[model samples]
Target: MELHEYVRLDGVGLAELIRTRQVTPPEVESVAREALKIADERLNGLTRPSFPNALDAAGDGPFAGVPFLLKDVPIAAGVPFTLGSRAIPDIAAAHDTELMTRFRRAGLVALGITTMCELGLSFATESARYGPTRNPYDPARGVGGSSGGAAALVAAGAVPLAHANDGAGSIRVPASCCGLVGLKPGRGRIPCGPDTGEAAFGLLYEFAVTRSVRDAAHLLDAVHGPAAGDKYLVAPPLRPYAEELDAPHPRLRIALTTDAWSGVPVDPEVAAATARTGRLLERLGHTVEVATPALDWEDVLAGIRGEVVAGVAPLLSAPRQPPPEALEAVSRAAMSEVRAFTALDLLRTFDAHNRVSRAVGTFFADYDLLVTPTLGQLPAPHGTLDYDNPRYSVDSWLRRLFAYGPFTAVFNISGQPAVSLPLGRSASGLPIGVQVVAGSGREDQLIRIAAALEPDFATAADRQGTLDQ
Candidate 1:
């Protein structure tokens, strides 16, 4: 298999080639290793090329023989789990997380882990520990994080699909910037267990970024199930999610909003791209209206803040915690600020979360889906969201992060399924994503809509060619 040939195929396409014996797993894997090395040099995404120690699929499955990469945030047995921070020493996981188990079961070849923001504290991938992950589309710009590394490599055609998780838009924002399909499956649709019950009190979701809607659907089909001790679980889909691609859905009532919840003015190009997606939805027989869910943006940020503080406080307070100098300025500030939080502060945070979730649920009772700009602006230049800057306190930093990605965290709070599709491009050729959100446990609907809308954009190979030029 040639590099061009390997980059052109999506995960399902590669699986077909393997299943039909057009190429052996070794042939495809060798090509994938070559692609990984080239992509790492060009994009600075993979934290370490674990090519020599890469794991092969155990049995034939949908993604059998397809090369894959894991984001460094999750635990994969024997792989380094850095969580993209210098505060914690990089150490290998003793065992696999449930999601990693499923990935293996689905026959995805584990290539290596990729880069992220330190503690995933910011929306940009510039961490003090491993430097920055550059966008393949334009190296001068940012690849949104903390899944930026995964998005960058996948965008540049290094791999068909890679592990990505979302906590306040980690997955979707990178997918938006990198021109990939980023699906943050509804809370509980995927498990995060064998270590923790729920990540960030269900504000976080585990999934992947893919080149096509079907790949996302197929990946979801392979991994969407509860582990034995999960804290949350939703009802299973009526049929396999892949089947939803061809299933005709009734005309959907969609709410489209370019307005940012954070009061940040959306970039004109991004807003126009969102509007164009709404028009495309209307043409596809869905009712598109300019409406938004009633949300208290402050309340959403507060809940996020509480979650961050609560999760990090224990780690920072531990006797063996890293030295104060090991962390970024923002992280050190968060460590200091969280010490002041009392039980009442946490109570208020939960109250805010309850209010925001209920309000969005009520809005969804009327509308089947909501469409918005996945980000408030185009990918920022490096250092735009610098974590090392001492000016930021925890609250101020969260505010800045949400302001750039004003539209995504609301769904994280609501625990709903949302997807960012690379539906439009700027005059300078940067990718702009249009986000489509569905009610809780309605990933099937999201899949159908994404498949319908996917044809409007250039193919991944075409975008990569443009980047190459």
Candidate 2:
């Protein structure tokens, strides 16, 4: 098959083709490598291209022969695992993390590793080490980080779907930018062990960015079990995620609010898209209302700041830290400031986090879902929030980042499952995603709603040629 032919297939399509013997796994892989070469020339998304050795050990499993890419943060043995940081030497991981092991067992043929923000500390993909991972929709715009490169590659058809994880909107942010389905699973829904414990004390979840909701659901089915000694494990889904795609989603009381949790004015384009989606949901028999959890912004910010700052200290102990010249200046400066935060600060953050979680849970008691703009604004120009800029302090930088992506982190803070679906477009032709957030351990519900909303967004994006096959 031609590379273009392979690029158009979702993960399931490729698997089906391989299963029927229409294409050998090696043939599909060859086409995928060709697609990667072309996509990299245009998007500059990869930090490591390990194609020569990537498919060597992928054995017969359910998704046999499907190509995949990993964001650099996850540990993948024999693949360069630089976290878009110049502070670490360019070295391959000694072993795969438990999640990586599951990905391989799913029969995913590894393509390469994608770039990320330094230690994933920033909202933009202007990595000093790997340069920039640009938006696939418009190369001049930014692809949201720190899963930015993985999103870019998938969005541009380098691979059908690629591995991604979210801490503070990393997956959803980029998925919003590139017109893909990005589902941020609830914390501990997927295992994160045998290397590091849960990121940010269970604030992060591993998943993928895909062209369709069913693809996202299928991928989750392949990788959503607890590893043996996991510190925190979420309850298992009643059935595989794919099974939920066809199940009739009951009429839901969905709360729709265009307001940003952080006091930023949501972009008019984003607001209109969300309102439009609310109308669509109403027409589809779901009850849509205008309401949001009354969240304390200050507490939310404090807890987020605390978790992020505290998480970095442990990563530094591993591997040698490079000389000052090797690190981004902003990163080097923030390292000292974060280190100085007292343990009491972390305790306070935990307290604040618990408060927000309880509030969100209370709100969800009355409403089954919360619908909002995934991003507060449209995609920014490529150089908008450069982390290497010496002028912006950490305080000012975070404020700007929060303003840009205000809605996504609230769910992250509350540990709710949320999916960003591309349902609208800016007049100038940019993708705007509507975020659907459900109560904790309700990804099955979210996926059903996502499967319904998916077509509307795909249709909207296609009108602008962004989702054209």
Q: Which candidate is the best by lDDT?
A: 1
On TM-score, the leading prediction is 1
Prediction 1 TM-score vs. true: 0.97
RMSD of 2: 2.0
Give me the runs in candidate 1 sitting further than 4 Å from their true place. 317-319, 464-469
lDDT (tens digit, per residue) of candidate 2 on 348-449? 888988998999999999999999999988988977777887666556667777888988887777888999998988998788988999988999998888
- Candidate 2, residue 444: Cα displacement in angstroms equals 0.6
Displacement of the residue 185 alpha carbon in candidate 1, Å: 0.5
Of candidate 1, the 10-residue stretch with the lowest lDDT total is 460-469
In order of listing, the candidates' clash counts read 0, 0
Model 1, 274-341: lDDT tens digits are 99999899998989898988888889988899878756876766668867798899888988888888
| Per-candidate TM-score against the hidden true structure | 0.97, 0.95
Candidate 1, lDDT over the whole model:
0.88
Model 2 stretches astray by more than 4 angstroms:
56-58, 459-469
lDDT for each of the candidates? 0.88, 0.82
Error of 2 at 450 (Å): 1.0
